[model samples]
Every structure is written in structure tokens, then in C-alpha cells.
Target chain A: EAGVTQSPTHLIKTRGQQATLRCSPISGHTSVYWYQQALGLGLQFLLWYDEGEERNRGNFPPRFSGRQFPNYSSELNVNALELEDSALYLCASSLGASGGYNEQFFGPGTRLTVL
Target chain B: AQTVTQSQPEMSVQEAETVTLSCTYDTSENNYYLFWYKQPPSRQMILVIRQEAYKQQNATENRFSVNFQKAAKSFSLKISDSQLGDTAMYFCAFTTMEYGNKLVFGAGTILRVKS
Candidate 1:
């Protein structure tokens, strides 16, 4: 089976600009998630969407937001990008509400470079 | 809140040798899940193994296995017959039902397999 796939493998943006990363989940999956992996800060959960609705969000600011499409694809939008925003943004998908035994599958992350 | 920690930032081992990566997590929930993910230079997150908190037996996948200590709250990954393809960044993660299944990740350990 094909794993999750992400687009725009790399992105470059200036301060105060916005960046958008896209992801397509594996077949038969209905949940999408976003995570940010900073150089030294580790991976932080960004957002979670299930069945086309926002289910949960991380400690990140409101500027970091995203949505899941009807087909289970997702897009992460980071507004007012700062130098600190530069990092590897990873997208993952899972089968939701199946007794919570869902294990997530991730895609190739998008490297966002904010100047 | 939950926190995961990987004390070893980097580790190396000869090919075909055995290596272990340590991880510790703090959580108040009685039931949860632990996962190990490998991120290669390609920046794709691949699930290495998983251990459920309530499961007495550890989880194993092919050459990868986990040492889960519930009382001590420790979950470590052990790779047997390591290969060059095992070189990657390994992350320890946690999730609970109350947390809406959002992952709480550790800083990560970089594992390098030597020839």
C-alpha cells in the first residue's frame, strides 16, 4: 500500500510571510495530523483533524492552523512566519475511533525555511 | 500533561550488532500508548514498534523490539542484527485517551550504524 505523501518537499519564506504545506493520507484513512520538528526542540504536535473537522490542537499559537479535506487530505498554514518557524513540518494520518489503537503513518516532511 | 525524554542524543553500533535506545515518559493516565518512529535522511517517519501500557508482553517487529517497564515508566527500543538502513533519528512518543490521541514526543535519538 502507498504511504502518506506530502508536496513541496521544501519551502522558503521571509519573515511575516505565510507558508502552506500539503499532505495526502494513505488510503482508507480519515484522520490527519501536523507536527513540527525543530532543530533542537524535538517534535511538537501541531494539529489534529478527523472527518473534516478540527479535533484538537497543540500548544502552538493560533497562527499555526490547518484543516482536513473530505478525502482525508490536509494542509498546514503557518502565518507570520518567523526565523524560529523554520523547521521540518511532518504530516501523518491514522484510522480514527477504532478503539484508540490507531497507529499513525507519516509522510515525507516539508522543510520550511523562514528568513 | 505528558512528557517523553530520550537521554541519548546519539548512538552508534557496528553492523550486525545489537543496540538499545532508552526512553522515559511521565504521565498520570493509567492507560496509554508508546511508539518509536524512525526518520531517515529522507525525512519520512516510519513506525518502528509500539507497546501498549496495559500489555504485559513487549511489542516487537522483525528486528526491532521494545522493553517496556510500566512501574518504572520506561520504554526502550532494541535493534538486533542492525543494518546500515537502521541509521536514522529515532523518536519516542506517548498518547492517552484523554489527550485526544495527540502524540507527545521526545527530543529524539540519532542512531548511526557503522560498517
Candidate 2:
């Protein structure tokens, strides 16, 4: 089966602009997760979407929001992007919330560069 | 809230040698999950190994293994017969049922395997 896939391997946006990154989960997966790996902040959880609902989110600001489609694909939108928002945004997927032990497979992250 | 810490910011190992990356986590939840992810220059996050907090046995995958200490709240990754391909950024992560699918990740350790 194909692993998680992300679009726009690289994205460039100016400060105060908006950016949209997309992710496609693996076949048969129902849970999608978004994470941000900033320069020195490490990998931080951004959002979790399962069964088309937002389950949980990290301490990130409301400007960092996303949604999951019925097909389990997800899109992360950043409004009023800032220089600190430049990072590698990664997407991961698992079986679902029921399978807590299921491993999450990740995508080749989308590198967002905000100037 | 849960937090994961990787103390070693950078490390190096010779080919065919063994190297261990240390991680410590703080969580009150009795049941949770720990993971080790590897990201090469390609920037694709790969699951290296996983350990369930309730499991007494450490998890091993090929040359990669984890030494999990529940009481001490320590989870370390040990790579045996290290290879050049193993050079990458290694991250330690934690998650609990209460947190849903949100993963708390460490600052990450950059491991360079040399020939």
C-alpha cells in the first residue's frame, strides 16, 4: 500500500500571507495527523483529524488550522503566516482512533518558507 | 500534558558499531506509547521503532531496538551494526489515549554514522 503522500514538496509565501498544504493518507487509514518541524522547535503536533472531525490540536495558535475530508485526506492552512512559521510540515496517518497501538506512517513533509 | 526530551542533540557512530540515543518522558498516564522516528536528508519521517508503555518487553526492529524503562520513564533507542544509511535526525515521541492522536515529540537527535 502507498504511504502517506504530501503535495507541494516546497512552498513559498510572504509574511502575512496564507498557505495551504495537502496530505493523502494511506489506503484504509482513517486518522490523519499534522505536525510542524520548525528550525529549532523540533516536531510539534499541530492537529489531529479522525472520521472527518477535529480530535485534538497542539498549543499552536488558531491561525494553524486544518481539516480532514471523508476520504481521510487532510489539508493544513496557515493564515497570516510569519517567519517563524517556516518549517517542514509533515502528515501522518494510522488505522483510526480505535487502534491506539497502530503505527503512524508519515509523508515526505512540505517545506514551507515564509519570508 | 506530556513531554519528551532527547538530551543528545548530536552523536556519531562508526559503521558496524553500536550507538544509543537517550530519551526521557514525563507523563502521568499509565498507558501510552513511545516512538522513535528517523528523518534523513530527504525529510521523510520514518518510524524506526515503537514501544507501548504497558509492554514489559522492549521493541526491536532489525538493527534498531528500544530499551524502555517504565518506572524511570526512559526510552532509549539502540542501533546495532550501524550503517551509513542510518545517518539522520532521530526523534523521540510520546502519546496517550487521553491526548488522542497527538504526539509529543522531543527536540530530536542528529545521528551521523560514519564509515
Candidate 3:
């Protein structure tokens, strides 16, 4: 089965410009997650959507936002991007609720380079 | 706020050897989940192994096993008979069993397998 898929694979944006990254979850998965992996930072959770609702979010700024569509695909938007925003953006999908045993499958991340 | 930390920034393992990566997390919640995700040079985030907070028995998958110490909030992954394909970045992550499933990750450990 095809795993989670991310678009562009890589993205480039200038400082103060806005960036949009996309993700398509597995065939039957209902939960989608977003994470940021910077040089020094490991993987920071950004946003999560389940059944078309924003279930939770991390400590990131409001400028970082995303939405899950009816088809379980997701889009992460960063407004007024900063140089510090350059990092690998990862998208993950799970089959069930955020339960302990439900492991998440991740996509080949989108490398965002903010110039 | 929950936080994960990986003290080792880099690790080296000779082929057919064993190497362990350490991770620690801080959380007041009694029930949660822990995970070790491997990102290869291809940049795809893959789940290596997972451990449930309430499970006393350690988790093992193929040549990968986890030594989980709940009291110390310590979770370490050991890869036996390491191969060149193991070279990549290993990230330790955690999430509560709640609805959000927001995963918190550490700084990550870069494992280089020497031939």
C-alpha cells in the first residue's frame, strides 16, 4: 500500500513570505499530524487533525497553521516565514484515535528553506 | 509542557555491532506513548519501535528493542547487528493517549554505521 504522501518534497520561501505544504494520508487513516524538525530541534509537533477537526496543537506560534480536508489530506501554512523556519516539515498519519498502541506512519518530509 | 531530550547528538556503530541511543522525557500524565522514529538519508520518517507508558514489558521489533524505565522517564533503543542501512537520524518522540496525539520529540541522534 502506498504510505503517506507529501507534495513538493522541497519548498523555498523568502523571509516574510507565506508558505504552504501539503500532505495526503494513507488510504483509510483518519488522523493527520504535522511536525517540524529543525537543525537543533528534534521533531516538534505543530498541529493535528482528526475527522476534519483540529484536535490539538503544539507550542508553535499562530503564524503556523494547517487544516485537514474532507478526504483526510492536510495543508500546513506558515505566514510571514522567518529564516529560523527553515527545517524539514514532516507529516504523519494514524489509523485510530491518538491511542497508545496506534503507531503513526510518516511521509518523506518537505524540506522548507526560508531564505 | 512536555519535553523530550536526547543527550547524544551523534553515535557510531560498526557493521554487525550493537549501538544504543538514549532519550528522556518529562510529563506529569500517567498514561502516554513513546516512540523511536528513524529518518534515513531519503528523509522519510519511519517508526522503529513503540512503547506504551503503562506496559512493564519492554518492546522489541526484529533487531530493535527498547529499554524503558518509567520511573526515570528514560527510553533507550538498541539496534543489534547494525547494518549500513541503519545510518540516519533517530528521533525519540512521545504523546499522551488523549485525543490530540500530539507527539513531542527530542533533539535526535545521528547514527553512522561504519563499514
Candidate 4:
């Protein structure tokens, strides 16, 4: 089966602009997760979407939001992007709830460069 | 809040040698999950190995293995018969149901395997 896939391997945006990154989960997966890997900040959880619902989000600002479609694909939108927002945005997927022992498979990540 | 820490910012190992990356986590949840992810230059996060907190036995996958200490709250990755392909950024992550399945990742350790 195909692993998680992300689009726009690289994206460029300016300060105050908006950016949208997409991710397609693996076949039969129902839970999608978003993460931001920023310099010095490490990999921080952004959002969690399961069964077309927003389950949880990290300490990121409200400007960082996303949604999951019925097909389990997810889209992360960043409004009023800032220079610090430049980072590799990754998407991961799990078979279901991902609460217990489920393993999350990740995508190649989308490198967002904010000027 | 749950936090993961990778003390070694960088490490190197000769081909056919072995190296270990240390990680420590802080969490109050009795049951959770720990994972080791490898990100190569390609920027794809690959699952190296994972261990369930309740499982006493360490997890091993091929040449990669994890030494998990529940009481000490330590989880370290051991790579044996290292190869050049093993050069990458290794991350330690933690997750529990109380956190809605979001992963808390470490700052990451860069491992360089030389021939």
C-alpha cells in the first residue's frame, strides 16, 4: 500500500500571506495528523483529524488550522504566515484512533519558506 | 504536558560499528507509546522502531533496536552494523491517549555513519 503523500514538495510565501498544504493518507487509514518541524523548535504537533473531525491541536496559534475530508485526506492552512512559520510541514496517518499501539506513517513533508 | 528530550545533538559511527542515541521522556500516563523516527536528507520521516510502554521487552527491527527503561523513563536507540545510509536525524517521540494521540517529539539527534 502507498504511504502518506504530500503535495507541493516546496512552497514559497511572504509575510502576511496565506499557505495551504495538502496530504493524502494511506489506503484504509482513518486518522490524519499534522506536524511542523521548525528550526530549533523541533517537531511539534499541529493538529489531529479523525473521522472528519478535529480531535486535537498543539500550542500553535489559531492561524494554524486544518481540516480532514471524508476520505481521510487533510489540508493545513496557515494564515498571516510569518518568517518563523518557515519549516517542513509533515503529515502522518494511522489505521484508526491511534490511541493505543497504532503506528503512524509519515509523508515526505512540504517545505514552506516564508520570507 | 508530555515532553521528549534527545540529549545527543550529534553522533558518528564507523561502518560495521555500533552507536546509541539517548532519549528521556516525562509523562504521568501509565500507558503510552514511544517511537524512533529517522529523517534522511530526502526529508522523509521513516519509522525506525517503536515500543509500547507496557511491554517490557525492547523492540528490535533488523539492525535497529531500542532499550526501553520504564522506571527510569529512558528510551534509547541502538544501531548496529551501521552503514552510510544510516546517516540521518533521529527523533524520539511520545504519545498517550490523554493527549488525543498527538506526538510529542524531541529536538532530534543527527547521526552520521561513516565508512
Candidate 5:
């Protein structure tokens, strides 16, 4: 079975530009999660989608947003990106709705570099 | 607000040896979950192990085991007979028992296994 798949393994953008990262969850998974790994901040939760509904988000700004599709695919959008936005963006999927025991399977992540 | 803290920024262990990484988290909620994830050079975030807050028994997977101390709010991972393939960034995360599985991650520790 193919694990979660993310698009544009690497992305480079400039300040004020908009960047979109995509993710396709594992088959039969209904939950997709997005996270940001900044240089010193480690992995911070960005957004979460379950059954094509926006569930919860982290402390990120409003510009940091995403949506889940009918197929359980997800897209993370960062508008007006800044240099601080350069980080590794990860996508994870799980079988259940809540609880951490569901075993979230992660993608290879999208390395976003903002100049 | 929940927060996870990994005191070790980097760790080194000789091949075939054992190493432990420490992590602590702060949460007001009594019921929650904790996890340890590994991100290799390929940058795939993989779940190493997970411990439920209510479970007294520590969670283990293969050579990976967690020392979970609920009273101290501490969770540490021990990798036995480490291998070169174990070289990666290890992150500790926490999540509440909410509807959406939102994760709070720490500043990861980079583990290097020397042959």
C-alpha cells in the first residue's frame, strides 16, 4: 500500500508570495494533518481535516490555512509568506477521528524555502 | 496551552549501542496522549511509539520503548542496539482527547549513530 503522498517534495518561494502544498492520505484514512517544522521551532501543528471538514488548527496566523477534499486529500496554503516560513511542512494521516493511538502515518514532507 | 519540551538538541551513539532521549510536556488536562516520531534524512516523519495517559504500561515497538512517567509529565524513548539507520531527528509530541487529534510537538533532538 502506498503511504501518504505529498506534492512538490521541495518548494521555493519569496516573501509576499503564496505557496500551496498538497497531500494525499493513505487509502481508507479519513483524517489528514499538517505540521510545520521551522528551523528552531521543531514540529508545530498547522491544520487538520477529517471527513472533508476543517477540524482544528494550531497557533499559526490566519494566512496559514488548508482544506481537505472529498478523497481525503489535503492542501495547505500560506499566503503572504515570509522568510520565517522556510521550513519542512509535513502531512500525516490516521484511521480514527480522535486520540493518538490511531497511529498517524506521515508523508515525506514538503521543504518550503522562503527567500 | 500545551507544550512539549525536548531538552537534548543532539545526541550521539556508537553503532550497536543504546541511547535515550528525554522529553517533558505540560498539560492541564489529565487525560491525553504522547508520541515519539523519527524523521530520517529522507525527511519522512515516522511514528516510533505512543503512550496513552491512562495506561500504566509503557508502550514498546521492536527495539523502541518509552519510559512514561505520568506524575512527572515525562516521556523518554530508548533505542536499543542502535544502527546507522537510526540516525535521524526525533520529536516528542502531545495531544489532548479532543475531537480532532491536534498535536503539540517539541524542539526535536537530532540523533547521530556513528559506526
Candidate 6:
């Protein structure tokens, strides 16, 4: 299996700008998860998309939003990016949203640097 | 709402030795899922192990194992016979029974392995 794959390994944007990160889930996976890992911090849940619907979102502001496509791929968009937004954004995929039993596979992640 | 905590910010261990990372989460849900993820310098998040709250047996994956205490809300990861490649940032996460739930992650612990 190829596992999960993300695009544009690195992205740079200025403060107040917008950034878009893309991810392709593993084959046969129907759930995609977005997470943000700021320097020296853990992975913070951003959003969860399954079956082309926004299932859940994190405590992050509305500026952090994303969607899942028909193919189960996902895109994470950060609007009004702040310097603190510089971090690694990861995408993970699972068979479904059935709690712990659903094994999740992650991608290399897109490193967004907000200047 | 749930919160995960990793008390150790950083830890180092010599090759062939063992190291344990601590994690604790608070949640009101009776059933949930917990996981440990490893993010290497390449920034790829890999699922290290998982433990279901309802299951008393600890989850293990080869050299990686977890000590899960449901009542205490504690889940710790122990790596036996660690190698230099074990260096990475380890994060503990939680997911509740609520449909389409998002993961709650800890601050993470940085593990460094030395030869």
C-alpha cells in the first residue's frame, strides 16, 4: 500500500494571507483527518471529513477549515494565516470513523511557514 | 471535551536501552479510543499503538507497547531495546464514542536515542 500522501511538501505564506494544503488518503480509506503540529507542540486536531461531509472540527477558529472530496482526498485551508501558523499540517486516513478499531495512516505532512 | 497531557517535554535514552513516555487524558465518555503516534524528523505521523478504553489488555506492536489504565485515564508508551531510529516526537491522542469525533492530542514528548 502507498499509505497516505500529501502534496507541496512545503508551503510559505505571509501573515494575513491564506494557505491550502492537500492530502490523498490510502486506498480503500473513507475518512480523512487534518491535524496541525506547531513547533514544540503536539498534533492538534483540525478537522475530520468522511464520505464527503464535514463530520467534526477542532476547537480552532473558523479560519481553519477543510473538506473531503468524492475520492476521499482532503484539503485543509488556513485563512488569515498568522506567524504562529507556521507548522507541519498532517493528514491521516482510516477505514471509517469507528473509534479505536479504525487504524489510521498518516502522510508526510505539509510544512506551512507563515512569515 | 477531552484533554491529553504529556508531562515529559523531552527524554533521551542510549541505544539498546528502554524508555517510557507518559500520557494522561480526561474524558467523561464511557467508551473511547487512545493512540500513540510518532513523528520523526521527516514529519510523518505514524501510529505506534492503540488501546481501547473498554479493553483491559494493553495494546502492543513489536517493541512498542502501552500501559493503559482506564480509571486513571493514563496511557504510557514503552519502547524496549530502543534503537537510534527511535528518536522522534511522540504524541498521545483520544477519541470519544460520539459519532465522527476528532482526536484530542497532548503536547507531545521528544525522544532522542543515542548510540
Task: For each candidate in the order shown, give its overall lDDT on alpha carbons.
Answer: 0.92, 0.92, 0.90, 0.93, 0.91, 0.88
Best candidate according to DockQ: 4
Per-residue CA lDDT of candidate 5, range B12-42, in tens?
9999999999999998888888999898988
Q: Which segments of candidate 5 are over 4 A away from where they belong? A: A98-101
Query: Residue-wise lDDT of candidate 3 within B1-96, one digit each (tens)?
Result: 788999999999899999999999999999999999898999988889999888999999999999999999999999999999999999998888
Deviation in angstroms for A85 in model 1?
Answer: 0.6
- Taking the tens digit of each residue's C-alpha lDDT, what string does model 1 give over A1-115? 9999998999999999999999999999998999998987889999999999999899899999888888889999999999999999999899974577598989988999998
Q: Would candidate 3 be rated incorrect, acceptable, medium or high by CAPRI criteria? A: medium
RMSD of 1: 1.1
State the TM-score for model 5: 0.95
Candidate number achieving the greatest lDDT relative to the actual structure: 4
Model 4 spans with C-alpha error above 4 angstroms: none
lDDT for model 6, please: 0.88
Candidate 5 i-RMS (Å)?
A: 1.7
Question: All models, DockQ values?
Answer: 0.84, 0.85, 0.78, 0.87, 0.75, 0.69
lDDT for each residue of candidate 1 in B1-113, tens digit (9 for 90 to 100): 68998999999999999999999999989999999999899888888888889999999999999999999999999999999999999999999988987899999999999
- If both were scored by TM-score, which would come out higher, candidate 1 or candidate 6? 1
lDDT of 4 at B37: 93
lDDT of 4 at B107: 95
Model 6 CAPRI quality: medium
Is 1 or 3 the stronger prediction by TM-score?
Answer: 1
- DockQ preference between candidates 1 and 2, better one: 2
lDDT of 3 by residue, A1-115 (tens): 9999999888999999999999999999999999898886667789988889888888899999999899999999999999999999999999857434467899988999998
Q: Write the per-residue lDDT of candidate 2 for residues B8-112, one digit (tens) a residue.
A: 999999999999999999999999999999999999888899888888999999999999999999999999999999999999999888888688899999999
lDDT of 4 at B9: 97
